[model samples]
Target: MSRSHIALVGKIAAIACIIFIVFCICFYKTIRTGFIEAQFDRASMYMQGEGNPQDFKKAREYLEQSATAGSDNAQYMLGVMYEKGQGASQDFSKAMNFYKQAANKNHAKAQYALGSMYDHARGVPEDHTEAVRWYEKSANQNNPAAQYALGYAYYNGIGTTKNIDKGLQYLQKSAENGYVKALFYIGSLYFEGKNIPQDTKKAFSYFEKAAYKGNHDAQFYLGVMYENGNGVKRDYTKAIYWYEKSSKTHSSAAFNLAKMYKNGLGVEIDYNHAFELLKRAANGNNIQAQYYLANFYDKGDNVPQDSAKAAFWYDKAAKQGDSRSAYRLGEMYIDGRGVNENFDKAFQLFQQAAQDGNVQAQLKMATIYFKGMNTPIDHNKAIEWYQKAANQNNSEALLALGNIFDQGLDVPKDQAKAVGFYQKAAEGGNVEAQLKIASFYLAGTNLPKNPAKAIEWYQKAVDQGNIQAMLALGQIYEQGIGTTEDYQKAFEIYSKGLSSHNADLQYAVGMLYAKGLGVSKDIEKARNFLKKAAQQGLVVAQREYAKLDLSNQVQDPNMQTVISYLQEAIKNGDAESMFILGNLYLNGNHVTKDTKLAKELFMQSCEKGFENACHILKTTY
Candidate 1:
């Protein structure tokens, strides 16, 4: 009993000593942590000038003390200060040290900061995969910024193979955690709908969230959605409201608001406010706003015409690689409207825009090179630019190329290639090219003489009000060139051109009526048409009108006039005119009696199937 009691007492004493020692150690740590927290708080207050004037030097001293005492928050803050050069000269290497200290304790923001250092190569070789690994760690701890970084990396395949669905999931998580950029970016994806099904309502929802959270782009899009009535009821008032909010910081939003004021879309037409807002947007480097502002000045639409101001804005936007603006500035330079005329400068600008894929600028470059404007003629460069524009389906450029090949203008004549370009231009709605292709089809020049194709292309031109095409199509039907002689089709086609006062069209229509070819033989219509054609001095119509007098249709007929008409008609091989003139000679009605002349005229008329002349020749002769 004595041995057991002594052993138990010793054990109790030893147990109490261990408990007391452990309590003392825990108490020491508690007091030290409290001291460190106070030091960190003082440092934050000093840095932020809260309740005192800011003193970066004092803040750094306090932060260093707290950080050395193993406070993760203090360590992270000191890291930011060193990394950003806040309290002293920047030292990313030291920042990396403090950030590692805090990150080792699983501080989410510190982990994110460490990832950012590696991501941006701050005191470390840039390593996106390494950044992504840390981002995943912080994201697992529900750090919204880390989640956003991870999502962006996945979205763009920066650190891992691209996975839109996975990226979208992480972005959704970040947005749910109130990351404004993630909200806005996700909203854009829904709005664009290129890789996903378009869901405007869903996009509006995300944008609304981001807008309220101070995302200017989201605010601008909200205005757009409201104004366009996309995924929402049309409410210009709400649109203007959102636009005004975003316009404070976003140039595009200001530009849109300016348009609403200018056009009186949902607000009073206020040119003053419109101009002010437009200038604001333009000065802010909104490319479209700059272009429109330049146009307003150039055309004097709303403001005083200031060519210099227009050129200024155009130059601004052109420097930003706006093709349309570059081309416009080139024109101003060429015409000396805003600056001293400099063709070389203009051509340089044109080439800039042409290289940027502006179809009009491409065509202009082609024209400049082809015409040797401000430079030696360079058909190769011209062809290059023309082909670029033609590739974009520019009808003018296609037609020009066709003409180049067709006329052998500084290039070897290639009828086959010319036909190909002409066909392309015609398909692009170039009326001249349509007519060219039609003529080719009709004449079997470069293209087969397919009447159907000719008629098809001619009709295309006719629909565009081309009188030449109308006349050509009319002649095709009238003369039965490569097809049946469709008099009715010919008459209809020619009638359309009568208003154009074309002598050929007038004569054709008259002949059709006089011969009872298309419409009924209306002598009055036939006479009116023949008179109009004759007044226009058509040689063919004059001969035909003279022959009409053999039917006794001319109102003021005289013997001399009648004799002259008959002589002209005989040359045209008219049997009736020959018989009438022969009778006049036999009777000496308009000339001295001459049986030999009369007999010769009668013989010619009889051989040409004039029954009356044949009867006279056999019985009276």
Candidate 2:
């Protein structure tokens, strides 16, 4: 062969070798891309259980392999698995790590997940600003969840400055994307009217949209609106419907539904159903439900009496900062009703409740200090607590203050201050304070004499069935002592005490009938009433009934009984009884007619200041 032909053949062979190497590189690239795609698809299929029984373990293994091969979807799935503990124990740190890997690659769901972790302090300390940064990145890519979170942050000034306009803009975008939470949040904003102008029609529209999408909070709000007729016709049936739907998961909704059943609203009262619903709400940690359940157990209302359970529920509510429950538990502790008596624990609970503005607890604190029941006597502390309760317009506290000032217990006697407190308490319908203020005004003691004011206060006390006040005010009206005589008013006031079993009231009413001072005169009625009082051992009534019996001139052999009654009256210092006895002896109506005995009785009657006897002696003798 020629030298030129051998050189050409070698160059062509080198060119052919270069072309074969290029083709092999292209073929390898195609196969590698397909392999990566296959790995991602297999992992996704396992995660979704597309053709086999669900196996989170297998899904997680496949996901780890694809995630290591740089698949963003696989990284996002692994983040979810770690977050939810589907294949292993939940670990927020691992979840955040995987989320960051996918988020760095601009995966929208992963970016949103990372934002939620920062927002909620899942693995790292919560940082609203950082959460907003990630949320903004995802929201810009039209992620509905991210848009809702960004809107909420803006509306509450959580991460960014509060801007209602921008918040509403983002929320509307998310709502348009069918995000139920955004729809519910916008409705709440309108209903609350704090950050935005309240529009109930708009609120109803948004709430209804979210409710149809099965948002429990939206359903609960719809129940409230329907029950109250807020931007809707009041319909208890609809309210119950919404409440039943939300009660599956909403504790407050369960409580409200229980109340409706208990109250027979739009349904027959079903106590059994109400009780079951209340138990469900209580187990769900509803604070109000716990408080009411405690009350039911404490009072034994429709349930077996169980003081221990009552105390348990009360303790639960007290731990949640319920002042009323704290006060009730304190009462049980101090009285040893539900638990062993512990004065120190009771005092501490009372102080806690008092500090939380419980008027009854404040009164308990004041009484403890005033009486030195468990602690050293400290009138200054007592006064401070009493004033705290009085500031809430508590009548008992006001009356207590009046007594303290009037009696000079802890300070110099201040009649003016006492009267001021008494007046306030009286105005608040306290019977004891009304009596105090009335006595002060009637006697011109520490107050200018005002008959009208005295009568007004006395009448107020009498209206509350105060026996002492009723008797005093009735006398004033009948005798024209403080005000003009109004026999009808006197009779009305006295009539209220007729059934009190009081001897004084019975005698007074009898005298009214005898003298026709109030009602029409009826001798028979007078005698009957006087007999009733006299039987109860009233000296005055005994003397009066004896006189009534003698006036009827009854020829009974039991004359000694009437005479003995007059003698007993005279012995008790009723001077008028001497004159009546003297008259009886002179007339000899129910006794022997003896002038010597009659003259002796008249002398005694005159000496005892009986003017009728003196007149008989001067004229008839």
TM-score for each of the candidates = 0.75, 0.84
Q: By TM-score, who's the top model here? A: 2
Model 2 scores a C-alpha lDDT of 0.88
Question: Taking the tens digit of each residue's C-alpha lDDT, what string does model 1 give over 1-621?
Answer: 699999999999999999999999999999998899999999999999999899998999999999989999999998999999988789999999999999999999999999999999999999999999888889999999999999888888987888888888898899999999999988998899847789999999999999999899999999999999998888999999999999978999999999999999889999999999999999999999999999999999879999999999999999999999999999999999988999889988998999999998999999888998878899888999999999999999999998899889878999889889999999999999999999888888888788899999999998887888888998889889878999899999989878888878888888888888878887678767876776665656666776675466655644565466567668778787677778878988648998899999999989999999999988997
Clashes of each: 0, 0
Error of 2 at 262 (Å): 2.1
In lDDT terms, which candidate is top? 1
Alpha-carbon local distance difference test for all models: 0.89, 0.88
Question: Worst ten-residue run, lDDT, model 2?
Answer: 550-559
lDDT for 360 (candidate 2): 98
